[model samples]
Target: MSNYKFILSGGGTGGHIYPAISIANELKSRFPEAQFLFVGAKDRMEMEKVPEAGYEIKGLWISGIQRRLSLKNFVFPFKLIDSFLKAGKIVKQFKPTMVIGTGGYASAPLVKVASAKGVKCVIQEQNSYPGIANKFLAGKAEKIFVAYDGLERFFPKNKIIKTGNPVRQDILNVSANVEEALEYFQLNKNKKVLLVLGGSLGARAINKLIEKELNFFAENNIQVIWQCGKLYYEEYKKYENKNIKVLAFLNKMNLAYTAADVIISRAGAGTVSELCIVGKPVIFIPSPNVAEDHQTKNAKALSGRNAAVLVKEVSLDSRFEKEFKSIITSETRQKELSKNIKKLALPHATKHIVDEIEKILKTL
Candidate 1:
């Protein structure tokens, strides 16, 4: 049994947390006896999610700087210093062979301390535009795993590896289960299905868009599987009926992907990676609230290649139905989008990243 010790830090949103978990799982599969520890921001989603994934996690008192002036800004410096001291202690106690950061507020201090202590560090940048935390950590990282090309603009050219973003393994084989997926979601196989995703917490604009288009979906004989997200479920649950299935969150995304003839979603880096692997015709309404407006950049990458369609939030009220109808009504468009998106899938990203970690470990 190999006795490698690892410290993984990332979490604030599911985008960061899931990739950290996926990487940890890939590492555990290869080294069954390996020890893993996850570091994340206190009171954040990762504190709950990491333990649920069957790993121990430590929470750091860290948060991102608010874009606007607020009381939190004054507390930021103290939190940073406290987190750094705590991260240093954790590194000394854990004595990890390597540290991996997937990018979140907590990741900054942990990876910084680990690198300062002369530990190997690897960072995964999930977006075309790197976040502030990852951009700062890039110099100290031994290798930087990126999901997009042209990231040499942010990190050193020699350190960047185009490994792609890690996605849930269950989503990889969705194509083979179409019939099962239709039955699981209790939808008819004869009608076209549109799956709408807004991520785990949910997107308010997407939810409102669906609300506006409900009658249009019914009139056109289309079925909808809408994952409205946890925060909006109570408000939108009344819309659940024969033709519309409203879920707070989808635990079986494989089934949802298989049932979808077309997907309408926010263009998160992880979502983009999964959609490419699922090979579905997609209409991207990128969330405008994200850092550096990365979601728009992600959607544009595919739309520019004719792999997906993009609809900006500002034009949604005037153009959603027209843009959505264009895809759903055309069989040739669906096939073309699916074929092109599938060409972009990097199914072995987790395995390849682990291989890089192994290479670094071998040198030790």
Candidate 2:
């Protein structure tokens, strides 16, 4: 097989960054001689994360338009034009045979430039509701990899493929025993474990809600594995008691997933994919501050299928306790949620997406 050059672009959040990394890793394993380049927004998390994943990356001077009126909105047009010109230069110099985008502001320019150059481009849409960047690129993309059904509304039907989202390889083969995981986290094996996740940067609403309910969890004999995330760890670390283990981040998410009987989490695309694979009963608290209110749409997709419970951030104060109590108190409900959610797990998503990419390249 001949060596191929490829460019991958995505950023802004771990949701976009991790999927891009996962896809790159899969491609590297399949094509050992492949040369890879990652393009991302300058100063974004992807600039830091892509290199850490052992890939060379270039950053574009780009950012998303803010929802509310701000000074950033006024400069959006100039940034977009500059990013497009820069992206065109990178694509011309790199001469990549194909470009793949997971979805972010950085991806918009790179994929657009690649497509204009007559290079094959593929985009992966991780959510049920597509982001503006992906939706815009979909028309010119050779293939559109999606995690959910009914995306024909956003992309051309002929170009759409239901390949799911690429998740961390470590999570795909989670084999930790429940008892071993409980012991590893230094928690009681007898008490039910409630794992709380609010993404890597953390959710202010979820963190505050968990703080108020710490005593209730203790009284109910529930052991807590709270990942307060990096941003909120300092503010909430004082709540760490015998029943609660607070962490800024959990590197060994497989252990945490194995240890948990139930989960309280935000409904980011990557998290939702991992949770489906973990097969635990979960109460989703979707972050409201995201673009297109996509997190709420993601949570509703699973909840609509009777796979998980959806609790809006605004309703956390009144609905959290009642919703959580119902699941924790009933084994039948827990089992039902677990079984239904497991049905949604596309364990071979990374491989399937790569297969589509290869098919598209062959046609090209």
Candidate 3:
């Protein structure tokens, strides 16, 4: 029973990769003898990240279809058929007790094949709007784990579980010592600290906005810990000075959360979940480039509940400073936002997800 094999598939972005890692980690803790095999699209971030998390992963020759007419789109059908055959082979070889899809194009073929082969499959949707893969697998997946409401429209209402999004375990404990965090970042204790996060790869618009507003932050006596992301670090590193700490990625994110008095971030689902758990006042600038603009919807869910502030990328130049100044300048506003946002946190999300996984395992 403890040696049950599990197959987890999803990737392309950190949004999908991190959640799958979190779930795998939790399952490992519960059943240390369990085998985990991750399946992802070759050359995707998951190919690198899953291994970093100490799990073995196999890559499929898969990629998403281009929206516009292109050579890539032309080859998509052949790729899909090839991937489906490979996924069927993987299912037959792995003989996994369960298959979990987090959300991405890579998960589609694998989950579809696994379910067709009568393997139990479950999926966790990280965004407010479900991705194409998750939507396609809805009918076949045994359970659908989701972070937001109103998804019954897309998935079977009976199978949907609103468990919130799974975030890193360290982030759940981010309320730890603020002074130590400040020291770790080498930040000034006298000034308000602002944490800037663009997703894992970095958001171009958010990075540009941060660069343009450096003078504004200095004028307001704010010190910043900016995680401009790996891709944007070189471009933004020149702006780092005594008051600003620029990082490609914050390996110590719990410390980053503790150090921040106010956070400005792109509203990716995983980031939003972590932010809610961190309980910091935030200004959400969602990426419009994403499918269905789900980031905006994720941010709006909290903003509508008075849990966070929503500032769209398009309106940032005109409204960001005003919104940011309002939150940072007022203790009452910060406290209110922090309190409301924390209330929305499902700190035990990983545990709950594993609990459900265990229930399915028992049936096996």
330: Cα error in model 1, Å:
0.8
Q: Sorted by lDDT, highest first, which candidate order results?
A: 1, 2, 3
Comparing 1 with 2 on lDDT, the higher-scoring candidate is 1
* Local accuracy of candidate 3 as per-residue lDDT tens digits, 270-323: 989889888899999998888878999999999999999999988998999999
* Candidate No. with top TM-score: 2
- 10 residues in a row with least lDDT, candidate 2: 355-364
Worst lDDT run of 10 residues, candidate 3, spans 167-176
RMSD (Å) per prediction: 1.2, 1.0, 1.3
Whole-model Cα lDDT of every candidate shown, in order: 0.93, 0.92, 0.91
Query: In model 1, what is the error at residue 59, expressed in angstroms?
Result: 0.7
Off by over 4 Å in 3: none
Off by over 4 Å in 2: none
TM-score of 1: 0.97
Q: RMSD in angstroms, candidate 3?
A: 1.3
How well is each residue in 58-172 modelled by candidate 2, as lDDT tens digits? 9999998887899999999999999999999999999999999999999999999999989999999999999999998998898899999888988899999897778888898
TM-score for all predictions? Answer: 0.97, 0.98, 0.97
lDDT (Cα, 0-100) at 93 in candidate 2 = 99
